[model samples]
Target: MIDLIALRRRLHRHPELALHLPETRETLLEAISSLGLRVETSTSSSSLAVVVPGAGPGPTVLLRADMDGLPVTEESGVGFSSSNGNMHACGHDLHMAALVGAVHELTRRREEFEGDVLAIFQPGEEGAGGAELMIAEKVLLTTGRKPLASFGVHVLSFAEAGMFYCREGAVMGATINFELKVLGRGGHAARPHTALDPISTAALIVQGIQTFVAQNSSPADPIVITVGSLRAGTAANVIPNTALLKVSLRATSSQTARDAYRKIAGLGAAIAEAYGLRMTSEVGPDLGPTVSDKEGVELVRQTVGDLYGAGRYKELTVPEMISEDFSLFLEETGGAFVLVGAAVDGTPHQLPTNHSSEARFDDSVVPEIANLLAELAIRRLNIASETNRWA
Candidate 1:
């Protein structure tokens, strides 16, 4: 059995920021090497892929865990507090520990498996699209081997520990971030009639965007448009020339995401025109939705059923509006992304949400996660072999 507490403590002490997870990467690589697995760096600092070569030729299975920490202060009160301002608010520390535990188990039982297993320790999953960067560096093609399928799991604080959740289609929402800048003539506060205030234009844009979401999106289809930040005048006696608005758009489907983006841009322009201000809207790349493969989902569900019985696993009726960069990996290899429960009794009555400073992960579920991942890899490899034998 793997010492999950030690692994989590190590990750907690060495919190790595996005694209700069050298310390965490080195730690994970060292652990993989200790397990007798050959480790390969992604040529970039964003990812590390380890391979445990099997005895025979079979389908290669890939298991992924995100390694980057969030830019939040530590408030969990654990003895292993992060020295830096960053914290593992998203339970990435638990993710790394669970994967390491799985690796340890797989290495011990390596003879039972036929094909090689790839363990992906990825960074920048918070928002920087580290998975995409890893793919660009050919992280998937480790040791010149391509994965037949991949699997990833995230710990959900809302559910009770030892339970697992997954769904067939659209498991997570697509996200698009944008910034709107409204430029106008600046003047003294007393001379409001002479100068155009961009703040007014920005306010109109925010209201218009909210109305657009209500009017355009279908009731059955979930969509969220939030203006997280707004900045305008610096001084009370001056009307600032520029106003900046930072917005995030989320939808279960790509079409919904596209529609929301179009509407937001149109509304910004219209609001600016009505307020006599010049509006410049910048849209960032879309972090597409997490669409789980049907077969892969069934495989994960069956594995969970075998471990926890059929009634214990629940299929989510609706996709979560929260975003994850792991969707990028699923998009590439056509795999499944699961949400593992991490709720614990006697702790905080209400578990803090991800990215919150007070967010605490239930370490008790680490072993369950390790078992699920190892079983998923074994099952996928066996299924592939059976299919090939029939062919």
Candidate 2:
């Protein structure tokens, strides 16, 4: 059995940010080398791939783990708390440890597996689109190996430890960030008739947005529109010339997401016009939904059945409203992303969710996660080899 706690500690001590995972990359490369695998670093700073070449030519399987810390500070009070304000509040440390454990276990049981396993340590998953960068560098093509399938695991605080949750399609919601600027003439606050207060207009716009969602969207189709930040006046006596509003929109389906965006944009424009203000709306890059392939999900389910027992796995019926950058990778290549249970009890440390400053995880399930990753890779490679033989 691998010492998962030790691995987790090492990663927690050296958390990496997007495009700055050199220390984390070095650590992962050293771990892979210890397992006697030939490791290849991407020319791009965002990724690294480790290949454990099999005795014979067979299918290649890719297992991915994102390596980037969030901007939040750690309050876990553990000895390995983040040195800088940046912390692994999203459980990327556990992900790296689990992937390393899987590599170690697969190397020990190399004879049981027939094909190569490529472990990808990708960076910039925290809204940076690092997966796209890695793929652009042709990490898959350069390996001279095409993956029959790919697998990834995410730690979940909502479920009990040792239980794995997965689904066939749309495991995560679509995310899009937007900003609205409301511009108007400025004057002294004492003379209300002299100035067109943009703050008042912005407030009305915000309220109008909520009403728009309620009136436009169907009750069954869930959509969330949150105005996270708003800025307007600098001083109580002066009406600012401009106001800015930053909002995030999320939806289960593409149509719903588009509808929400349209409604929000239209509402902002209408409210600004009614208040004698000019509005400019800007939309940010899209974070696509995590849609699992049917065949890939079935493969994961079967592999988990062999490792654990039948009926131990549960397929989530409703897709989670949470968003993940891993969805970008799934969009490029068919793959299955799973959520592994890591809940804990005591002072309710689990009360804090991901991105929360008080977020914590049950470290005991690290070994199980490692085992699950290895099994998924082995099974995918086996299926690929079988398909090739028939072809």
Candidate 3:
């Protein structure tokens, strides 16, 4: 068996970012090569799919783990912190290690089950649309046997470590990236009336944008619009020609997401027009929402409960506002993306959350997720076989 803790630490030390993770790819390739699974690298992106066959023919199941790191510099204070100015603040390193552990456990017990397990190591999930590219390249269909179900696990920073938390529908919200350029006439700062200040216009738009979700959308449906970045004049003396705003929109449903985007864009345009400036707004690709199918959720709930006892599993009453690209898998093949809590030392308040430079993940949850993924695949395989037999 691979030394999971050691492997995770190694990955954590040397983090890679986005779709072009050559080093991460090589590391993952070496880890899975000895297992004798049929592995293929994606021609379009830095991703690979490995097929592990069982003792006999049955439905196929896909287990996925994203392999990408954030661009944030490490302040996590771990001995294994990355020195290259990149950190796995979101715990993708742990995801990779846990999936590898699952591969180790499932391949050893292949004789106990009868199906193929396609383990997908995906990169560029942070914002590069890795899932969409893989889908276009047919990552799901490459296993030869059509996958009856798919399963994926993500680590959350605040939830209790070694526990699983998720909801059945819309567990994660959809993400939309928007850039707004507020253009205005540049003039001397001394002549206040002469300058059409875009910086002032952008400030107003930023403060007013949040009201779109609160006033326009229903309270029952959740939406979040955040202005992550704002930049204007470099010097205090001159009014800049343009101001820029980079914002993110997350919503539980597509309609809510779209509606929020429209309202915000319209508001920005109006603000610019009133200031005698031109505002151009463009929205990026939608990172689809991760929603769990009913059957898949029940299967996971039962499997985790059985393995770690009922207390280890809990479903959230409301979906989380954060977004995930795993939504593509659920949209295509109908599956569940389970959220396993990995708060550092099981105390969320003490440590930073995911995407934080100081964010730290508990390694103890690594094997727990591994066990959950393995058991989920086995149980789903049996359930698929029984359903096929009846049909």
Whose TM-score is greatest here? 3
CA deviation > 4 Å runs, candidate 1: 345-350, 389-391
Alpha-carbon TM-score of each model against the true structure: 0.93, 0.90, 0.96
Better of 1 and 3 by lDDT: 3
lDDT (tens digit, per residue) of candidate 2 on 1-391: 5577787888887677886788888877766665666777766674778886666677777888999998877887777788778888888888999999988888877777677888888898877778878887887764576666678888865567777778998888888888999999999888978888889999999998888767765656678788978998878899899999998888887677877887788878988998788899998756878889998889878877888876668898877777777786677667899987776655433367776777777888888789999888777777767777412
lDDT of 1 by residue, 1-391 (tens): 5588688878987788888787898788766666656877765674778887666777688999999998889887777888799998888988998899888888887887788889988888877778888888887778466787889998876567767888998888999988999999999999999999999878888898888888877767878999989999899999999999999999998788988888788779888988778898898758989889999999988999998798768898988888888887788778899988776554433777777777767788888888889988887877887778312
**Ranking of all predicted structures according to TM-score, beginning with the best and ending with the worst:** 3, 1, 2
RMSD of each predicted structure: 2.2, 2.6, 1.6
* Superposition TM-score, candidate 2 onto the true structure: 0.90
Candidate 3: Cα lDDT at 381: 84
User: How big is the positional error of residue 323 in model 1, measured in Å on the Cα after superposition?
Assistant: 1.8
Q: Where is the poorest 10-residue window by lDDT in model 1?
A: 343-352
- How do the candidates rank by lDDT, highest first? 3, 1, 2
Sequence-dependent TM-score of model 3: 0.96
Off by over 4 Å in 3: 346-350, 389-391
Each model's lDDT comes to 0.83, 0.80, 0.87
Report the lDDT tens digits of candidate 3 across residue range 289-372: 799999899988898888989998898788888888988888888879898888877457666889999898889889888889
Angstrom error of the Cα, residue 114, model 2: value is: 2.7
Clash totals, every prediction = 0, 0, 0
